[model samples]
Target: MAGGTDAGAGAAAEVPGLVGVPLLGSLFDLKSDSLGTYLRAQHRHGDLVRVTAGPPGMRAELYCVFSPEGAQQVLASEAANFRKDNAFYQEVRDSFGNGLLTSQDEDYLRQRRLVQPLFTRRRVDGYAGAVAAETASVIAAWDKAPDGVVDVSDEMTHLALRAVARILFGTDVEATAEAVARCFPVITDYVLRRGYSPANIPRHWPTPGNRRAAAAMDELYGVCDKIIAERRGAGAHTAGRGTAAQDGPVQDDPAQDSAVPGGAGEDLLTLLAAARSSDDGEFDASELRDQVLIFLLAGHETTATSLCFALHLLARHPEEQDRAREEISRVLGDRTPEAADMDRLPYLTRVLKEAMRLYPAAPVIGRKAVADTRIGEHTVPAGADVILAPWVTHRHPAHWPDPDRFDPERFTPEAEAARPRYAWFPFGGGPRACIGQHFSMLESVVALAMILRAYEFEAVDTEIPVGAGITLRTDGPVRCRARRVDG
Candidate 1:
């Protein structure tokens, strides 16, 4: 929140940058194609390029960090010096509530501590059953597809939403899933538009956009709140006798004993309802809604993106697809896949990893420099808005040769060990990394293994244009023809 000291200010060399039109700079270019802008900036201006836009008083200077080394410095090594104090993040926090993804400083620390246990490897693996069930449902539904053609994008999105909803709400999943499907697009689109805009009309104003976003939020919040209330009521019936609240937190085994009345026992909602810390008590109803909302937003969309792209890539490359399918068949024959199958099916994991390498969910990560920090040879002054782009860093020529190629071999254990830790950070790195990392991977590997096992895909749409939103998004349907593997 403070600026760089006067002592360091004069000596700090200016970062090499892209100078666009006078006053406006590169704002329009960035707005039009941020991913392209990031790539061009890295290729033409090197990793640490300054990209400024807007007129004098409203100008925004983006200190872009594109190299693996620089990404590490900003996101991991010198992470404390780079805080999530940017406008985009603030907008997210306001829209979604200060849950783990948007919370900072002590609040982030507290949220992480409270939410960590729920996402542990042991706990996340438990959700694989849910993922398998959801994936099976999707695979079965493909039987109705006309001529066995399906949109990988739409299908994966639906599958992921169902999977996460089932895990999060359990028996109440049906109640929450449709609402999330209907409202999330409205909310995320609103966040993106307002987040990038230089200025925005006050949300309270009766503008059409504001009214629409408000209605969507109300519907979304209303549904989630009703479920939370019902879950609490059910918990009270089971544990509190006639009282509305539980006696206290489930201290002995919060993860296991947190089940409520309807057999939604180990679902994330129950866990959050029962989550407690020595210093901090359990989440209140409002807090619970916030955490659930954030999880739904982050959980489904990211894995769906990874699954869509992975299937599309495999559809486009049959030989690679065959190799991955062979591995799946060898490892899991005539049976549903589970989380434990992840290590046994290493090649499939590599396929998913390679897909993430190409199409990372969160492409452009933002931060504000908390102090004068040296990145590579450039000094990013305190208070400067910084961008850590995984989309660019994952494809950095120094780290990834033939970066544009879709080769799962790139993620082989040996190849991965040889590369910089930050070179292929699709889940990001450091303390503030995604809390649901294991859940995401577990869901993806299990779902992908099953889907690949069910169908042999041939890409109908060989190419998909993408744009950056809250996550990487496709501009058009990623279509593929699915023939039954048995046939």
Candidate 2:
């Protein structure tokens, strides 16, 4: 009854759609090549496409908005009409806990109010030293790589994990990074498998998959909980500072100073542990764990994907790589990059932006229409699923003339200004836009600059096929060989 309702008497025709085969609908197609499916749907139909899946008796209808304008409407203008009341979000919330990423309404607002201060430009920039240190470690290891070829995907993933971990856990980075690196993939995979299924056994059941996922969840939670408890009990200011003080007295050098303010060796974990709202409400232990878990999961995986693809693309295109390298050389001839250098290297920043465009970390975003809404000519009735697909919209031919081609110039000032606001959002737009977007860009630009300055890359595995997991995942290794750059 709800599905049949219209926006009004003059509502436009039904949304163009892909009518899948009987029974299973587009399940197999989605499970196989979701990105391709979204792309084809846009090419065949129009922006607003209706997709139906599942059996006749249990059919699920999805209203897909793939145009920049439509995306703006769904994610920004009329964002309240579309809610994260979908199944996938529920799965993420269940496993990851309702941190800023999945929380809604007042809870999200409160979390945002408290967490926003931690991500200010000044504070995030302070983490540049941490990012550079991690990149240096990766470069040092690559210096000894057999034949100079390294798995770019795996290496970036580890590098990003360590970088974020250092900023999050400080001296405890080694232990936390190890546990997270081991446990996050298992949990994310479990979330994906169960999230998409029409039916699932209770997670507490003793099935192999259940047991494995539960074990991973326990291990991941154990590490975070342990650190959080120690921080709370010992006091956030002094808890994680043990190793820093033991290693040596505080250095006067800016490069060697702790990433946090006051040079007290404070990490983001301690900041979160001690953050207080206007009313002096702090995150409880469970709330602290939830925030840390989401930060670990979102912080590392998205940035790693960006760095991997950026390096791979530059490898595939030598001229672009040289240009970027030249900029880095000109800016910082023989010194480590800092927060101030983020804006100094614009071309390198463009390369990173282009890479994100081609392989957005979160390709397909899910939402549900809570009321009858008109998108263009079609009316999406109440209680229908809605999908805002950056994967498809990024390649929309109307704006991006040659969408698939790798061109950093597309992000140049004039070019970017000419396009619609939502046309190039790797981070979703609106009140709910990614809180870590600035942080992601800073980490990416800083790391990419340092790595390119250190080595020249030539892609060995160029044709990387990616799939939509919880985030974009490469189907196989993305390999590249690096030769050290001479001054």
List pairs with backbone clashes in candidate 1: 259-265
lDDT tens digits, residues 111-141, model 2? 7777776676776788888899889988898
lDDT of 1 at 134: 87
lDDT by residue (1-487, candidate 1, tens digit) is: 1222234655655688897898899988988899999899999989889999887888899999988888888888788899988888887887888888888888887667677766656657768788888899889989889999999999999999998898888888887899999998888899999989888888999999888989999999999899889878887224421112233342334434333322335577876777775576678899989899999999999999999999999999999999999999999988888778889999999999999999999998999988888765668888999998999999999989999999999988899999988998888889888888888888899988988888999999987999899999899899999998884
RMSD to truth, every model: 3.8, 5.5
Q: Give me the displacement of residue 382 in model 2, in angstroms.
A: 1.7
Error at 17, model 2, angstroms? 1.4
* TM-score for all models, in order of appearance: 0.93, 0.93
Query: Residue 440's C-alpha lDDT in candidate 1?
Result: 89
Where in model 2 is the C-alpha error above 4 Å?
1-10, 237-265, 278-280
Q: Model 2 — TM-score against the truth?
A: 0.93
